[model samples]
Target: MNESALLAILLSLASAVGYALAAVGQSRLAAQGGGGMGQLLTRPLWWWAVGLNAAGALMHVAALHYGPLTLVQPLGALTLVAALPLSAYYARRRVTRREWRGAAWTLAGLTGLIAVTGPASPGDALSLSEALAIAAATALLLAFLVRAGAHSSRGTGLGHATASGIASGVASALTQTVTASLSHALPGGPLPWWGTSLVAVLVATFAVGGLLLSQAAYRGGLAAPLAVVNIANPAAAAVIGVALLGESFHGGPLGWLTAAASAAVAARGVIMLTGATPADLPTPLPTVLPTELPAPEPAVRITA
Candidate 1:
C-alpha cells in the first residue's frame, strides 16, 4: 500500500476506537434507564460520548479523503474488538468465550478485507442532484426505522440499531463527496453555494440523527446491537461507493470470493455474541454497532 492508504488505515483505526469508546459510554447511560433529556445533557459521560463521536467523524472524513469507501468501511468493524475491554471495565462485565470467539472472527474477516484491497486514490464526487436524491431516500428510511426501534424496547433493538448504521453510513458517503468537492473548490474550481448549503444540512441531519438513534438503541444493553450496526454501516457504504460513487473492488474474482467468505465468518461471530451478557449484569444489551473490534490464538477458553 502507498503512504496515503496506510495513513487512511491508521486514521480509520483511530476513528473506530473513538467511536467504540463513545458507544460504551452511551450504553452505560442507557442502562440507567431514561435520565430525562435535561439530566442526560448535564452528565459528563454524555458529553464525552458526543465529543468522541464528533472527533471520530472528523477523522473518518479525513480517512475517506485518502481511502476508498470499501477499505475504510470494513475497518470500522474493529470497534467491537476495541469495545470489549472497555465494556468489561465499565460494566464489570466478564468476557465470555462466545464474545471472544466472535471478536476473533470479526478481526479475521477485516484482515482479509484489507489484504484484498489495494491502495486508494481520490475518486469522483457526487453532484448536487445525486446527493439530494440520496438524502431524500435516507430520510424516509430513517423515519421508518426510528418508529420500529421505538417499539422494539421490550425486544432486541435490532431495527433501531440498523437505522443508526444506515444513517451513519450515508453520512460517511456524503462526507466524502463534500470533502472532495470543497477541496476542488479550494483550487479555484467553481463552488455552488446552494449545493454546498444543501448537502451540509443533510450531513448534519444524518450525523446527529444517527447518534441519537444509536443512543436509543442502547436501551437494552450493548453487544448484539453493536454488531449489527457495524456490519450494516460498512455494507451500506460499500454499496453506495460501488453503485453511485464509481468505486470497485480491487482484486478480481478470487479476491471477491475471499471478501465474501470473510464477511460470512464475521457475521457468524456476531451471532455467537448476540445474546451473551455478563453474568453479573441482569439487563440485556440492545443489538447493532457504532465503530466497533480482535485476534489471537487459544489463550482464552472457547465455549459453546
Candidate 2:
C-alpha cells in the first residue's frame, strides 16, 4: 500500500481504539449514576476519556493528511461495530441478539455509503461563506436539540439516545469543518489566527457535545444509543459531504439506487437495536450467598 493508505489505516485503527476506551469509560460512569455535565466535567475518568477522544481526533486529522476525506470519514463509522463487542467483553454487559442484528444492518448501510461516495481530493477546502453557513446551521440545530433534550426526563432511554445521536452528529460535522479550515489556511505557511480559532471552537464543541451524548447514551443502554449515534452521525456527514463538498457516486442512477439500498440495510440495523429490551437477554445474578441469611431453623419454623 501507499504511504497515504498506510497512514489512513493506522489512523482508523487508532480512532477505533480511542472510541472503544471512551465508550467503556462513559458506560462505567453512567452505570455508577453520574450526573449530567457537572459530573462529567469533574470526574478524572471523564478527563481520561476526553484525552482518548482528543488523541483519536488528532489521528483522524493525520489520516486526512494522507487520504481522501471520503475514505477517512467513513472509516470512522467502524466505531459502531467496534463498540458492541467491546462493551460486552470489557464492561460485562450483554448484547441482545437484536442489537447484534441492528449493528450488522447499520454497518452494511455505512459500507454502501463509503463504496458509493466519490473520492475526495487531498487538501480540499471550503469557502469562508460556506463554512460560516454550515456553522450557523449546525448551531441552530444544536439549539433545537438542546431545547428538546431539556424536557426529556431522566432514564428515558430512547430520548436520551436520540439526543445523544444529535450531539454526536453535530460534533462530527464540526470536526469536518475544522479539518477543512486547518488544511486550507495552513498550506505551506504558519496557521492563520482565524483557522486556529475555528479549530479550537470545533474541538471544544465536539468534546463537550460528545461527552454529554455519550453519558446520556450509557444511561439509556449503551449498545442501542451507541448504534444509533454512530450510524446517524456518519450518515449526516456523508450527506453533507456529498451535497456541500461535491462528492458523487459512479454508475449514475444505478449507483444511487444501490446506495439507497445499502442505507436501508444500515437503517434496519438501527431499528433492530432500538427494539431490543434488557429482559430479552440473561442478566448476571449475584453468585455469592448473603452472609446474613437466617439459619435453616427459620425455614423449618415457617413451614405450615
Local accuracy by lDDT, each model: 0.76, 0.68
TM-score of each: 0.77, 0.74
Question: How many pairs in model 2 have backbone atoms within 3 A of each other, for residues 3 or more apart or on separate chains, i.e. clashes?
Answer: 2
lDDT of prediction 2: 0.68
Q: Name the top TM-score candidate.
A: 1
lDDT string for model 2 (213-262, tens) is 66766775566667666666656566666776776676789889988898
Give all candidate RMSDs, comma-separated.
13.3, 5.6
How many residue pairs clash per model? Answer: 18, 2
Candidate 2 error regions (>4 Å): 1-7, 66-75, 91-94, 122-124, 146-203, 281-304
Which portions of model 1 show Cα errors greater than 4 Å?
1-14, 35-38, 59-76, 110-123, 149-151, 154-156, 185-191, 278-304
lDDT of 1 at 93: 57
